[model samples]
Target: MDPRPPDETPGPGQQPKPPFDRERFIFKTLAVVIGTQLLIYSLAAGVCGQRALVGRPVGQICPGTLEQLQGGFDSTLKLLLALLGGAALTRMAPPS
Candidate 1:
């Protein structure tokens, strides 16, 4: 008789590993990345707009703000394209 609890040990023929889920993992990672990008861009837009809203002189604007905003937009676009590509690949994959 084994001293360990039954549930604590794997029985013969009982593989404890769960099945690998590639599709679900990829989609979830993409969702998190896209959400992060969206948040960055939204904050950048707000900061850029604030300077203009308060009647600040044009020269007072931070030069890096525009660049950062543009970079954020570009990154977000790439992430969206990646998601679309993933979806396309999944569709083209052979049915299990």
Candidate 2:
């Protein structure tokens, strides 16, 4: 005979986790991280180069601003695209 009864339900605070919880968690985390990077890139592009801010002189770019813009446009965009591709691949891949 099996131990205990077969029709038992879990008690409160013991609900079963969803089957794709890990995948959902991964997707949410990546979304937040990539979204933040997009925001940063936008800010850098707005503030840097040929723009006159409150204290900054006209046509003077802030140090490291160009690098931030470059990375945001190049590397960050690539990573964001890759995340989309990865998500699609994950959805299509067979369950292990």
Candidate 3:
């Protein structure tokens, strides 16, 4: 009889499975999503330029519309920061 727990015991010719790491999984997923978003945003900004995004001449003073667009971007950045901060905190917490 095997002395190991049933779940820990591997069948003949089978490798033991590693324990699932929730934290690593979450970090990797977030990295991929954030990386993709950055890539997309970089491409858009490069191709479209600030003038296209803001619908104004470059270096010209603008009001309302630029702020609205900038506010949206700022909100998105804040949300991403919050998500990353929460994930970091969760990782630092002691396991239950």
Candidate 4:
């Protein structure tokens, strides 16, 4: 009847490599990373723009001065800090 051998075979130190799903993991991780970066940049840009328009040059009185620009820059830096906070939140996602 059967002359070959048993179907179940086990090699030394080769405990059937616990099935790795690479493609799914890669796509999901990339999506989360890229999305986070984009969100951070968008948030920073929006905040800075709003701060820059706070005051100055009303009714063609005059262009914005250094103080106004400095205020905007300071707000931009704060926005960056907020962005960092947003990115940190992504660490809790899957496949850590």
Candidate 5:
């Protein structure tokens, strides 16, 4: 004679939530932050390294074009890894 439908289970028992894991959470967050910083640094390295240095007082060239190319490739790899890391972290996060 109660109005509620039989299909609906009463409150708390129906859903069981996982306990918070602070260590795991902190570790994950730290990893994510490191990944983000790496990504930024990589991209910045590509840009900063690519600049043509015309006149250095020293006769020797500090960085040649090959170094710039290497920087670009390294940066691209770091950026790609960061994105992949973020995806993994997102999956690991708790629903709460």
Candidate 6:
């Protein structure tokens, strides 16, 4: 017969291990990054009168806001594409 209880938990000052592993962490990170970028782009597009569904026909944005939003969108897109391309290249590389 065992002396210890079957449902033992961590002792004081000890931390429990996370439920998710490395793959889950990576997936969550990617999801958050991509989701955030998409949200920002959508909001900016709506604000700048560029989104097809929610945007107004006449321009309602401030003079510099539209340009700034476009520039930010372009930069973010380039960065995301570069990161995805690099990851794909690494994945496709043969083991050395």
TM-score result, candidate 5: 0.40
Model 5 over residues 1-96: C-alpha lDDT tens digits? 988768644486567557798657766776776576567656655554554343324322434544655675577568657767887898899988
Q: What is the lDDT of residue 66 in candidate 6?
A: 56
22-45 per-residue lDDT for model 6 (tens digits):
545765676687677678767765
- Compared with the true structure, model 1 gives a TM-score of 0.53
TM, every model: 0.53, 0.49, 0.47, 0.37, 0.40, 0.45
Ranking by lDDT: 1, 2, 6, 3, 5, 4
lDDT of each: 0.74, 0.70, 0.67, 0.58, 0.62, 0.68
Clashes of each: 0, 0, 0, 0, 0, 0
Evaluate model 3: give its lDDT: 0.67
lDDT of 4 by residue, 9-40 (tens): 56887776567776557556655755665565
Model 1, position 21, has a per-residue lDDT of 82
The top-ranked prediction according to TM-score is 1
Using TM-score as the measure, name the better of candidate 2 and candidate 6. Answer: 2
Candidate 6 ranges with C-alpha deviation above 4 Å: 1-61
Which scores greater on lDDT, model 2 or model 3?
A: 2
RMSD of each: 6.1, 5.2, 6.8, 13.2, 12.3, 8.4
Q: Give the local distance difference test score of model 1.
A: 0.74
- Tell me the deviation in Å of residue 86 in model 6: 0.3
Per-residue lDDT tens digits for candidate 2, residues 31-68, read 78777777876776677643655656645456567666
lDDT of 1 by residue, 32-77 (tens): 8767777876776676678669987546355576677678668767
Error of 1 at 59 (Å): 5.3
